[model samples]
Target: MKAVALYGTIGSLVLTALAAVPAGGLTRPDTAGAGTPAPAPPRIAFGRCAPVERLPSSVECGRLTVPLDYAHPRDRQITLTVSRARATGGPKVRQGALVFNPGGPGASSMHFPMYGKTERWRKTARAYDFVGYAPRGVGRSAPLSCQDPAAYAKIPSASPREPSAAFKRQKYAEAKAYAEGCARKAGPALRHFTSANNARDLDMLRAALGEKKLTYMGASYGTYFGAVYATLFPGHVRRMVFDSVVNPDPRQIWYRNNLDQNVAFERRWRDWARWVAKHHKVYRLGTTPQQVLRAYDTVRARLGHRPLAGKVGSAQLQAAFLKTGYNDAYWPVRAAALSAYVKGNPKPLLRQTLPQPGGEAADENSNAVYTAVECNDGPWPRDLRVWDRDNTRVARVAPFETWDNAWLNLPCAFWPRHAPRGASQDPARFATDVTDAALPQAGAAHRPVDVRTAPGALPPVLLLAAERDGATPYPGAVELRRRLAGSSLVTERGAGTHGVSFGTNTCANQYVERYLLTGRTPARDAYCAARAEPKPVLPAK
Candidate 1:
C-alpha cells in the first residue's frame, strides 16, 4: 500500500503544446519471428439492466466475460463486475468512458460509479459514462475468501518483537503456517494474481466496453494498476491519471518499500511531535520537540518490556503507529492517544484496530497478489543475507516501524512459486521520447528505469503526487515523472494524504475534472497548491 508522495517547494510551472508522435515511434517493433501480426481487438457489445442489488437507480451494473489468460483465449473465462453512471447533460458533445480505480489491491469498486454524482464530477459526467470495475479476485467478481473469519481474528496484530525466544519461534512458525494454509486453500488462481495478468484483464474490459481507448483515474495502489495497464495496452489508452504513483522498481518489492515507508513516517512523526510541543496544553508530552520524541521512545521501550495493560504489546503499538502515519488528520488523535497511554491510561489508545485473525487469508490474498505481480514482473534478491543486512540497517535508523514491516512480508522468503520472468526493461519503448527541453529542470535527477523487462508502448499519463505523504515520499513521484516520458505530473503541494482524489483538494479535483470532461490535458507539468483553508470557495461571489 506504499505510494509515491507529492510534496516540496513550488517548482516553475510552464505550459507547452505537446505534439503527438507517430505510433511507430511510440512502440517497439515486434522482433519475435511472427507468422503474422495479431488482428486488432474485436468490437464490444453493450446492454442495459436493472440496478444492481443495492445501488441507486442512476447506477447501472453488468458483467463482462474475459479470458482467464490472453495467451490462451479459448482455455477459460472469468467474470468482471462493471458499474456505470450515464451522462446527465442534454446533448453529448463528446462520447467517451471514464474508468475509476480505488486503491486496495483488495478494495471493491462496486459503488465507485456513485462518485460521479459529486459536484465536481457532474461536469465530466455530462458527456461520458463514469465506469468502475471490480477486478478479478475482488468484490462482486469471483472473490477470494477465507473459510473461517475467526481464523483471521487469531492471527494477532503484528507483534514484531516476541518477548521471549519461544515467542519469536512461535511467531515465525505461525507466519509459515499461515503461508502454507494459503497455498493449500487459495487453489491455482493464486499463481495467476500477478499485476501483469490484471493489466491484461483491464484491456479485456476496455474491448468489452466497445471503447476505442481507455480513460482512467486510479488512486494509491490503483496507480500501479493503471501504469501496468498503460504499459501493456498503450494503444488502447486515451488518457490516464495515476494519483499517488507506486514505485515500479520490482527489486525493492513490498518489504523494502515498507522499510522505506517506516523511515518516512518517522520523519513525519517528529514533525507532528514538534506541532504537539507548540500546543502543549491540548496533549502535552513535553515543551520541546526533542522532549516529545524521547517521551515517545520511553513509552515504546516500556511496552517492549511489558505489554501495556497486558494486551497492547510493543508489536501492536508499532502497527498502530504505522497506521497513524497515513494521514495528517490522524496525528492529533494519535498524539492524544499516545499521551494518555504513556500516562498509564491506555483505554484511549486501545481503540486502535487490530488485524483480524485467520484474516490472513484476505491479507495474504492481497499481499500475495502484490508480491506476485512485483516478483513476476522482475527479479528480487534471492539472498537472505541481503535482506538481513538491509533489515538491520533499517532497524537502526527507523526502529519503530521497520521490524513490523519485515514480519508482515517475511512470507515472501519462502514464496511457494518461482518468480515470473519478465521482458527486459526498455525505457524508450514504454516512456515518451521527449527531450530535456520539454521537462521541468529542477529537483532530484530522475532514476533510470531499473527493471530489466521488455518495455511496452504507453500512452500519455497524468501523474498526481501529494506533498505531505509519508509512505511514498514526494521524491519518488518526481523520480517517476522523470522516467515516464510524455507523462505530465500535477503536484498537490500541500495535500497531506496519500491519494489525491475523493475530496482532497479542489485544485486536484478541478484539474482532473477538466481533463476527463474536455480531454484538456494540462499543457505541461502543473502544481495544485495545498488548500490553505477548509471548504474551498468558488472564484467570486
Candidate 2:
C-alpha cells in the first residue's frame, strides 16, 4: 500500500491488543550448531560507499552480512548496504546513532543519512550519527525481482472504475504470474523479506554498531516495520518516532489497508477539489467541488482516448494526482497541468512532474519486492475468488482506487509461500497465554505488532500525524499511541501531508527534534495548526 511520497490504510479498524506485553521472554537462543563457537559477533565492514553522485561526502557506507534465515544462522547469507552521516561535535553534541527508514517495504533509504546535512534537520542532526539501510531484498541488499518485467503492466488499472469479470480474470492471471516470477527469481529472499526479518536484521546491525539500544524514526510502511521491531525487541529501543503511522491491526496489515485507502483518498481528493473550487477564478475549470471533479474526469477521459503526446495517459494522470491526497504542495502545479491540458496545451501535461509508476522504464524488481514483503508479511486470501467479491463490494461506494489498489496487491493472492511448521502453535512455549510476548497470530503470516505480549515498557517515543492525512489516516497514530503506553502523538490540525515530521510544519518537527536529543515526550497528545494554504494563481497574462 505505498507509492513513493504517497500511500496506503484499513477499514473497521478495532483496538485489538492494547495491553503492554510483559517483558523478559527467554532471549531467543542462538541458531549456531551446538559445537560451533558462537559465530564471531557479526560486524560491518565499513568502506567508501559506492554511488557517490547522490550521497554526501560526510556519509560513510558499508555492508553488513546476516543469515538468510535467522533460524539457520550458518546457511545462505545476504548483505545489506548501510550508510552513516556521523555527528560533528564528538562527545559534546553526540547523543547516539539515529536510524531512519523512508518506508516502502521496497524504498531504498540508505541515503536518509543525508538528511543530517539539510538545514531543516541540522540541529537535531548534530547530536547523533544518522544511519540508514536498504533492507533485505531492496537496493544494494540483494534486491528482489520478478521473472517477467512486462507482466508488471499486465496488472489492471483504475480506468473504467468498476472492473468486469474479464478484468478481474486478467488481474488474477497477471498477479499469479507475477507471484510465480518472484518465487522463481527471488529464491531465498522470497521466504525471508518479511518485516519480522527486517526487525531481526536491525538487531544484528544494532549489535555491530555497538549501540545498547536503537533510537529511530520511520514513516509510512516504516512505521509498521518499527512497530514490529519494537514488539520483537522492545528492550533495545531507546527513543523512537513514527511519522504518518501505518495501520497496526495484524488482520488489517495490508489487504484491509488497500480497501481503507480507497475511502480515505476519495475524501482527500474531495478536499483538494474544494480547494481548487474555492479559487475557481484561477483554474477557470470549476465553480464547485463537483465541477472541479468533473474537470478532472474530463482530463482522465481525454487521456484515455489520446494520451498527451503518447506519454501521459489516464493511468499516469491518476498516479500523479494521487499526491494531491498526500500534500497540498502538489495542488497548484498539478492543477496547472490539468488546466493547461484543458486549454489544448499538451506540453505541461507531458512534462515529467510526479513519478508515475508506469512512466519509468519497466521496474519489475522494486514492484516484486513490494509484493513479496507485503504478501509474506501477512496472510492474503489465496482464493482468487475473494478478489472479485471484496473489490467489487468496495468499488460500489469508493471507486477511486478500489481496482488499481486491488491489482497493486493482487499478486499476493497468488504468492508462492507455504506456512512454516508450527505456524499456528507457539514455536517455544510461545504464548500459551494470548497476553504473552508471542501475541496472537491469525497464523504464521499475520505478524501484527503485539503490544500486549511484548515484554518491558518502551522508552518514551513520539508519533506525528496530520489530522486529515489520507495516505495513513490519523486514527492509526491514535491507536498506536493508545497501544504503546509511553508514546506521545503530535498532530498538525490539518497539515494533510503523508510524512509530516521534517517538512514545513515547524511545530511537528520540533517534537521530533526534542525527543531525539532530550528524550522528551509531550505531557500528552498535542496539536498544532496547519500552515496557511497556498492561494490560487493570479490572472494569467
Q: Report the number of the highest-lDDT candidate.
A: 2
Q: Give residue 88's lDDT in candidate 2 (0 to 100).
A: 69
What candidate 2 gets wrong by more than 4 Å, as runs, is: 3-41, 147-158, 353-363, 420-456, 537-541
Prediction 1 TM-score vs. true: 0.76
1-541 per-residue lDDT for model 2 (tens digits): 4734322211000123222112322123133232222143356766678973257677788888877765556767788889998886677889888888778767767777877778888987789888888888876688777865554553223365555678677767767677667777866456677776777777777777778788888888788778877876677788888888877876566677777777788888888888888888787879899999888887787776676666556776777787788778878877777777677776666664334565232245666667777877765655455556777777777666677788888777666544553232212233233222222332324344443222246787788888887778878888788777777889999667787787877887788888888898897689888977876653322
For this target, which candidate reaches the highest TM-score against the unseen true structure? 2
lDDT of each: 0.57, 0.69
Least lDDT summed over 10 consecutive residues: which range in candidate 1? 6-15
lDDT of 1 by residue, 1-541 (tens): 3342222100000012212213322211122232222223444333453444367877877887765544345556677778787777756464677777776565556676776677756777777887877777765466554234355434224354323456545655555555455456655555455555566666666666777678887776666666656554556678888777666553343444566676876676666777677767666688998888778777777766776556666666766666546666556667778777766677777666344444455554444444434333333333344445666677677665666665555444444442232222221222322121231111111111231112345555678877766767666576656655667778888555666654658888877777666666675578887754222111110
Q: Assess the local accuracy of residue 328 in candidate 1 as a C-alpha lDDT between 0 and 100.
A: 61
Worst 10 residues of 2 by lDDT: 6-15
What value of lDDT does candidate 1 attain over all alpha carbons?
0.57
What's the distance in Å from true for residue 251, model 2?
Answer: 1.6
